[model samples]
Target: MIRLRYATMPSNGGSRTSTGTIQTPPTPMADTSTEPEVQLRMFSQPRFLAAVRALVGTMAQRLGFTEMQCGQISLAVDEALCNVITHGYERRPDGQLWINFWALEGEPTGLKIVIEDLATQVDPDDIQPRDLDDIRPGGLGVHIIREVMDEVNWERRSPKGMRLTMIKRLQPGRNSELKNE
Candidate 1:
């Protein structure tokens, strides 16, 4: 199990953003097949979204992702987190959400971001983006996430809540490699 502590600072409960940094090094776990991950936990509030965006963008850049790729990854992550804050936590500012960002190793390296929340359980099959042709302001987050991410999956967590996993391939020809013949 992953252990992390997030220190919450005072916020205006509006547009202000609070960031909690985890200085702990990524340690190899028993599951050797996957790479070690850096964990981040923060309050589920609108104000903290900016901090999450910055963290994911910086991590992507440091992992050799181009400016465009970093932006795409950040936007996708932002949408995911926003969904957790809005739908999962039901806009409760005091609720907590956990995120794990890591890079895959070996043959074809890529980025993976996992967001877990304990507010509500969501069925993967029930998630549906609004029709793009409808052109509405309130329902495009899911569409944007799908367009930007190479792979997007929603998993119902045991006990409660759900986990949203978003992956992006940094290589040029990753699309072809990830596609089935």
Candidate 2:
């Protein structure tokens, strides 16, 4: 996994403060190897959805899923993120969406994905897939997600927002190093 590093510097050409001393901020170091790799993005806009989809697709492929399966998984993830932007954040571009992807560390040997958003929380019980009998341009996200992933779970965050967890087991006969943690 790649590491993201950032360091803070004095804003005023190294000028001393009122106390006649300069202070340095601590550098930020992230332990990405053992932790679930995380990506923070702004998805409250319709335009950014494709990039999100591409990212998910790439990750899915990297996990040894076939191209076709990657597309399906990516589409499901796209729909879920769209719902987060439209419903959870109410289409407000300022809200942040956090997505994490990791290979499980135990028996299952599959991919694990978790999406989190600091937007309005929705009751998990209130979420349902639209009836297929009625066709429409919208409201099929929940259904698509359930259809593609082996496991789907939604939860309201403790203080605010919501989390969606989706998992897919390794394809039959395929071997992978990823396992449940």
Candidate 3:
């Protein structure tokens, strides 16, 4: 149970047909840049991660993010999805989650990644990155996403579930840094 949709610019050459539809040349930008660009609905399954990563990475690349930044963006998203499956769904493969990708408009152009799940409600206070000194094999999703994205936050939904939001903005000269705010 997984579905993904992205707003891709028209690939048709800039032309007008008898149908009275305008088809512009494909640009590096996507229509989602001005609105909610991508939407993904998926089950709590690990098998779809690879495809998701590829799509996300390509989207980031098209958004004019650097190669390294694109990779980081995809990786952070993967980590977030894994966390939702592992923690929110408690490893239940059938639980459902919704993911949305948004392009922000401002002095610092950016992308916003949001994931919502109804599998379980988590206490925000209990969500913390494990000590890095321990060197554990897992439980590092939060740390990875936080370090990779400019802004990150986790919110508890009413009655049930959780929502996680992460954003990355291209700063002056396309450099990136975590926004402590």
Q: Which portions of model 3 show Cα errors greater than 4 Å?
A: 8-35, 175-181
TM-score against truth, every candidate: 0.76, 0.75, 0.78
Question: Is 1 or 3 the stronger prediction by TM-score?
Answer: 3
Pairs in steric clash, model 3: none
User: Compared with the true structure, what per-residue lDDT tens digits does model 2 show for residues 115-169?
Assistant: 7777898889989999999987899999999999999999877678888889987
C-alpha positional error of residue 31 in candidate 3 after TM-score superposition, expressed in Å: 17
lDDT minimum window of 10 residues, candidate 1: 23-32
**Tens digit of per-residue lDDT, candidate 1, span 1-181:** 2234433335655332233544342232213464335567777878877877887887777666778988989998888888888888889887677787767655467788887777788779989899878975787889889999889888887667777888887785443222221
Please identify model 1 stretches exceeding 4 Å from their true place.
1-35, 173-181
Whichever of 2 and 3 has more TM-score, that candidate is: 3
TM-score of candidate 3 against the unseen true structure:
0.78
Cand. 2 Cα-lDDT: 0.71
Tens digits of per-residue lDDT, candidate 3, 25-123, equal 112222333535677777789998888888778767666678898899999999988988887788999887777787665668788878777767877
- Candidate 1 lDDT at 25 equals 28
